[model samples]
Target: MAIEVNGKTIETDEEGYLINLAEWNEDIAKILAAEDELSITDNHWEVIKFLRDYYDEYQIAPAVRVLTKAIGKKLGPEKGNSKYLYELFPYGPAKQACRYAGLPKPTGCV
Candidate 1:
């Protein structure tokens, strides 16, 4: 599938994850929010930005446990807990959130 944003096209896999991670930015985030049926809020954006930065720095997409732990360290305990993370991305924080963040699937997810 392809996601069109302001006349530019981004390719996605059958599951809606961006095929090319290089073609991502805040604009792509907006398109992903729409594709995922989410209303982009400050909190949601925070998580998305964090995911992108984490990928850039670590070169790996974190699993749910790692994500929660790391996010808790950076954001706060309340924001980084599994319950909170799951509330934000019910399909699995590492999976769904990474997809929206235009990142590759986290290793060991399946």
Candidate 2:
């Protein structure tokens, strides 16, 4: 599949994750967020950027549990909980946020 951003076509997998991680940019993120009818907020960007950094270090997208723990460690307890994450990415924090961040889907997500 493909999405048009800034008059450029970006390819995606069947599940909608970006085909090329190197091609990721803020505009692509906005397009992904729009697919879910969400508007990126500062809170959402925090999680997205956090996930990207986490992936950069680990070379893997985290599942929800790991994501929560890692986020707690990095971003503090207030923003680490599932409640805060779910409020931001109602469709499943790890999956949705990773998608927006242009990381592959988390393991064991099904």
Candidate number of the best lDDT: 2
1-110 per-residue lDDT for model 1 (tens digits): 99888799889998888899999877887778776787677888899889999999999999888999999999999998989888888788889889889998899887
Error of 2 at 68 (Å): 0.5
lDDT tens digits, residues 1-110, model 2?
Answer: 99999999999999999989999999999999998899999999999999999899999999999999989998899999999999999999999999999999999999
Task: Write down the lDDT that model 1 would get.
Answer: 0.87
Each candidate's TM vs. the true structure?
A: 0.91, 0.97
Q: State how far residue 56 of model 2 sits from its true place (Å).
A: 0.8
What CA RMSD would you report for each candidate?
1.2, 0.7
